[model samples]
Target: MSVIEKFSLKDSLAIVTGGAGLLGKQHVEALIEAGADVIIFDINENALEETKKYFLKKYNTDVLSLKVDITNEDEILKAKEKIFKHFSKFPNILINNAAIDPKFEKNSAVNKSRLENFDARQWNLEISVGLTGAMLCSKIFGAEMAKNKRGIILNIASDLGVIAPDQRLYKQDGLKDEEQNVKPVTYSVIKHGLIGLTKYIATYWADKGVRCNAFAPGGVFNNHSDEFVNKIAQLIPMKRMANLDEYKASVVFLCSDASSYMNGATLNMDGGRSVW
Candidate 1:
């Protein structure tokens, strides 16, 4: 096939966890644009329907939206059954994009999310959804792909996964470093765990024609306070945050035959943030 043709996902099926969120929506749109049939799986019913409607109208193509709690094994299996019923096979691509990144704005009030004061329940929930959920999807949906001897599993990691969060970026006036609002530790742990999972699955399934990889994307802009945006931007070599749609091409390439030779790798699309 020609180089351009290798990027085509015509008639292939992709399951994107967290398909209703900001980044998830972009992944759904990119896969659809590549001519792949997309299945959006998320726990939010309303958002699922909204995403389905918007994409179906915008792309004018049929897509499946299922309200799935990725942390629930039973729910994931049922969703897998639905996919099998509709497509008569497992999804050719799995984008493990579901994770909780608690809004700093909401949690920063009076240092509500300081690491020493962080809630254990919240940490467990985030880890369950981000790390455990990805593993379940890989074991269940990925098993089908492994059996078929052809598929791709793309884990959505973060720049924070490769390096520690600069707590200074989150520093606010009058707050000590300990009490200052900071990125939750769970976010980093979950993302880093995903990279490890990607490498493990990539090798375990290599002979089965299934490829596994991770994409460590940088922060995407979504209307933060000017101070916050500027603070983070200064840390990045690009001197700017990524637009939500910027990662779409990377998604298409990693999920399509274009990345056929790639496996056991973590592609960092961090706009030079990690370098600094």
Candidate 2:
């Protein structure tokens, strides 16, 4: 049998947090393709329901979409109980895809002059969702995996976490034109922390058969402008951002038994952007 067939999830259950977002929905779609029953945990009830409708129609698989807050342990625990009651056990796979990328959502033009003005509140929101949410989900679901001696936790990190950013991107956040570095303070800080968390948990539970790892994807154009997307494309060695298939493939590997031996390693799925 091929890897897709042999590596099928079959009776396994996979829980993906932030399942309503751009990347989160991709994770859910990949899990369903691999034959795993999936449960989506996100705060957006409408988006979650929409995702459920999409999958139900396409794959004809039963997908559970739970409207829960990732930052709240009580909400997660309650969702866990429901999952257990329905599936009889905790999920064998956990994909931490929910994150907040701190960039201008509405503005497209680059203003090199106004580099020092930024919302501290925006930065905090990024950290809370990107870092805190990942930590919480791991603590909750990882414990269950340890007891069963089988589980895979995939943390979605970013390439920016590895390298410093150019001042232009953050020039509006307060950087002189001559400054060589301009990092998005909050997003970068949190992704760095997530890598540390993955290593810590991997070593702490190596004997329990739970493998924790990460995938740092570069420049995925979900809803960004063409100008912004093309600019990021130039930096990559492959000269382009990854397509949906590329992202889906990497995620599927981490979810399936093909990566059973992998732990605490962050795979750079940047289309060779980090090298340049």
Candidate 3:
């Protein structure tokens, strides 16, 4: 088969949580390019509608936009029902891309102190949104995929989850930026924990013909400052942050039959950052 045909997702049903975000929108677009029917799920209604219009106009394909608070089970169920009612089947691919940065709120994990101010509450919020939410979504989506006896799941993780941060790498940003680095306790801890969950579900659900995997992307240059991006780029072997196409390739692989043998695997699309 040709390269495109090998990875084609024609007629597949895809659900991409957090489809309104920068990286999420790229993912949705790539899936649509690969010929899958997509459902974009996000809590931000305005952004979701904007994404829907853009995709419809650009791709001339029907895309569903769901206003869903992923952390809430009832809300997720309602979205699922809507998806089923419209598509008439379970999603063949689920992309768990919904996550919150802990440093967004001023009172949040903004780390005013270095090696001294480690707030548990700040850490907990990261776990709630980044880790716990992914787990819950996996549970619901996996069950649905199981019932159908076929599907692919790709969970988004960070390279920081694999390796701890170095204080030296945070010099340009000062101690405050260092403290707020994504490698801080909560986000890294949860991401590491997410890998464990991915393995477990992949093994336990192997018999059901469902595959679970993770894409550990390094320093996506979305919403991060130039100094922050530059500081991070130095540590990576490739000396660059990830592009949308790189992230999209790995995501599409996890959702396609091309990666059929890759279950319980954590594909690091970090430009060799994790290797260092």
Of the two candidates 1 and 3, the one with more favorable TM-score, higher being better, is 1
Judging by lDDT against the true structure, name the best candidate. 1
Badly placed stretches (over 4 Å) of model 2 are: 1-6, 101-120, 167-183
Ranking according to TM-score, highest score first: 1, 3, 2
Distance from true location, Cα of 193 in model 3, Å: 1.5
Clashing pairs in 3: none
lDDT, candidate 1, 19-109, per-residue tens = 9999999999999999999999998889998998898789887779998998999999899889889888789899999988686444354
Sliding window of 10 residues with minimal summed lDDT for model 2: 106-115
Global lDDT scores for all candidate models = 0.90, 0.80, 0.80
Clashes of each: 0, 5, 0
Query: lDDT per residue, candidate 3, 52-109, as tens digits?
Result: 9998899898789999888788888888889889988889888888887544333345
- Estimate candidate 2's alpha-carbon lDDT, on a 0 to 1 scale: 0.80
The number of the candidate with the highest TM-score is 1
TM-score for each of the candidates: 0.96, 0.87, 0.89
Worst 10 residues of 3 by lDDT: 104-113
CA error at residue 96 for candidate 1, angstroms: 0.2
Worst 10 residues of 1 by lDDT: 103-112
